[model samples]
Target: MSSDLEPHGRIGVVRLGDALDWSTAPDVRTMVSTMWDDLAGGCLVLDLAATTFCDSTGLGTLVSICTDSGERGVRLIVAAPPPGVLRMLRITGLTAFFELYDSAEDALRSARAGR
Candidate 1:
């Protein structure tokens, strides 16, 4: 499991691992939650371009983050999720629960634009 977080003005950009399964969910969640708490305001953009896999547990953690974001009045978005992960979201009917973008930049633009 490998990931990196980069802070953009008003946005926390997360470049996630190749696989986000049970083995990686906890750390990912912790890093993201901490970042969100630190940000106080703005949006979270998960750059899934390098992510090749995601399991139900990983998806659940993401949903948890999304839920927390709503309570914090922060937006949560996914940028460039791989085809498999995207399909899983669709299959699980979770696609509607998130803002899907082609890239982190697009996500930031839409979020800042209040779209």
Candidate 2:
């Protein structure tokens, strides 16, 4: 998997590519953790538009990130998740646990408005 970080004022957008599975989830977690200093009290948009697959490990990673973000006062938003990922989140009853948007722009706008 690949990830790119883009900062827009107080919002940090992380665009994830390829697949988010067991092998990549740890890296993703580390990447996000390392950016916490820059993202604290700001918003984080996980742009998963290019991510094609997400396994159980990926879902767990996402949940952990969301929980940690809350503790750090960072808002975690998921944008453009593929159908499979969305389905997995729903099946796991995490749809209500996360803030989701159709696109990164939408998520960014919403986060900005809330601020």
The worst-scoring run of ten residues by lDDT in candidate 2 lies at 1-10
Whole-structure CA lDDT of model 2: 0.86
Give the poorly placed runs of model 2, Cα more than 4 Å off: 1-8
Candidate lDDT (C-alpha), each: 0.80, 0.86
Candidate 2 TM-score over all chains jointly: 0.90
Q: lDDT by residue for model 2 over 26-96, one digit each (tens)?
A: 88998888778887788888999999989889999999999999999998999999999999999989999
Enumerate clash totals for all models, in the order shown.
0, 0
- As a whole number from 0 to 100, the lDDT of residue 12 in candidate 1 is 71
Q: After superposition, how far is residue 81 of candidate 1 from its true place, in Å?
A: 0.9
Encode model 1's per-residue lDDT on 2-110: one tens digit a residue.
3344455566777887888899888888788777665567777888888888999989988998899898877788998889988999999999999899886787688
